[model samples]
Target: MPCPDGNAGSAGASPRKEPITVTRITDAALEVVATEGYDALTIRRVAAVLDTGPSSLYAHIVNKDDIDDLLVGRLSAEIVLPEPDPAEWRGQLLDVFSQIRDQYLKYPGVSRAALAMVPTNLEALRVREGLFAIALAGGIEPRTAAWALDAISLYVSAYALEQSLVLQRREHPDQEWVVSREELMRRYTADSFPQTRRYAAELTSGTGPDRFAFTLALILDNLCPSA
Candidate 1:
């Protein structure tokens, strides 16, 4: 009689291939963060998205910190660093920082993960090198250049994370702002908040990009006074 299970007995049958990999896991984790915010990102959640058990993820990633590191490293690699121009150092720095900020924004909550991280990853180190080169070429002292890079990086990451939070809030109507701008203005007028009412237009003067440019200019001016 023929074998009861045809495929089970067949020598020509193809073996199942393993689907798990570091890149696939990282991509799934980023998707979770992009769609549901950072707070929703967890090893279990990532595993679920991959249709695998949480235990399977442990073979690749050590912990949540490992995942965060990978996410930061992956995103940092996307930054396109400009060649340092001594005569155009300020503009170069501005362009580089803007690229970093835009990349973080693309990944939503990933910037929050980068806040406390040092540039241990190769890609992150490359970004640091570019910033330092620009500052140094512009005649900034070494120590001052280091400190300025730190401050600028923190500012960009914090700004991106804050914007991500605002976007998340906007996605959920139930968590909308408690006070509308019109209502806040009315309250300010009623309460006789003289300064707020007097300069309301100036206070809300710039769009997001405008405010970002103004703030970047302010930091660069103070950090590279001689430039």
Candidate 2:
């Protein structure tokens, strides 16, 4: 089957041959992860989607984490990194982080998949490589650059996971019903926590993009002394 445009299976396609086979299992994996989150992902569920036995899925993936890793790998492939420019290294970092946040939100359960993923695979390694190049261009030490990349990725993933949980709770009202008791908690905080109430607008302001921009600015400002 020909891979759809702008999707993973599109890689390595050519007019001369049939598009690489995209198993129903692969499509189902994405669906399961997106809809149910990583904890709920299972070989049996994927097999059910493909109308195959769990035994069959075992041939392709060792377990749920294997499939989850594949999902993150697919995500990495979709991200486009910029060529390092010394003059614009900071902007490039912001773009990369923004793209990561956008992609994770788009996929819903991606934050869970990212939790244990290391940059060992080709796609992930490429991102690390790109970050290293940018960091070098900006005069950062190699060790600092590597650790900083890991730190930034962890920060972004944590934020994405928090956002995903909120969205999931909202979408699944049954889950939200239990969580709905927390409205009083917010009120309580607003009353008892002076800072929370005083700057509630600042607290809620531009949560995604604005916060990202602010974070990037703060980091860049600190790094300016080094630059």
Candidate 3:
């Protein structure tokens, strides 16, 4: 798909088929994602976007994994990690997680590269170091801090992927698949699900941000002393 005139960050019609550089390759990959979605990302796809061939991409990046690392590294550079504040560690973390989520949602499905992978790039490691420093400052033990950060990162990545899929489904708008609020309530009949029926309205009340914050709060509550 040809991105509109100003959406340079999205999929292009292979318009930037110019000289190959690591930076250009990264941008082309993201544009491919923005235009064709993340599932369509590949060595050939990115090379096509860059107006080059797959072998040319391999000269700079080892493979698709390298591209994933580069993409995460680029995004890590964009996230402004706050100075470690002992008293406000929870809030600080909330801000960081929110920032990460927003960035991942921008590219869609890119967070999959981060799951179960070591920080392959300096920028990505910087985020981990920043999170560890903040958590440690808040009195969390070293080992706990490491595991907590990993858990939170996992959830954040999973959440981004799920959200991206939901967005794609919403774009197509299939009524057969989507359960409307009304439809959901009707399914929660008292006989089959009494307690769920009682809290049907409450279950569906929160907006996406509200639910995101609630989950983050649950995870962050016990980490810091003051919470």
Query: Candidate 3, which segments miss by more than 4 Å at Cα?
Result: 1-17, 174-176, 224-227
Each candidate's TM vs. the true structure? 0.88, 0.76, 0.87
TM-score of 1: 0.88
Where model 2 places Cα greater than 4 Å from the true spot, the runs are: 1-25, 177-191, 224-227
Best by lDDT: 3
Q: Flag the better candidate by TM-score, 1 or 2.
A: 1
lDDT by residue for model 1 (88-114), tens: 998999998999889888877788888
Give the Cα lDDT of each candidate: 0.83, 0.72, 0.85
Q: Which candidate tops TM-score?
A: 1
In candidate 3, what are the lDDT values of residues 1-227, reduced to their tens digit? Answer: 97667766575455554578999998998898888788999999998877677998877988788988998998899989999998899899999989999999998788887787887799998998998889988989888888888998999999899888877777786533666778877887557788988888987788778888888899889775423
Q: Global CA lDDT of candidate 3, please?
A: 0.85
Please list all clashing residue pairs in model 2, or write none if there are none. Answer: none
Ranking by TM-score: 1, 3, 2
Sliding window of 10 residues with minimal summed lDDT for model 2: 14-23
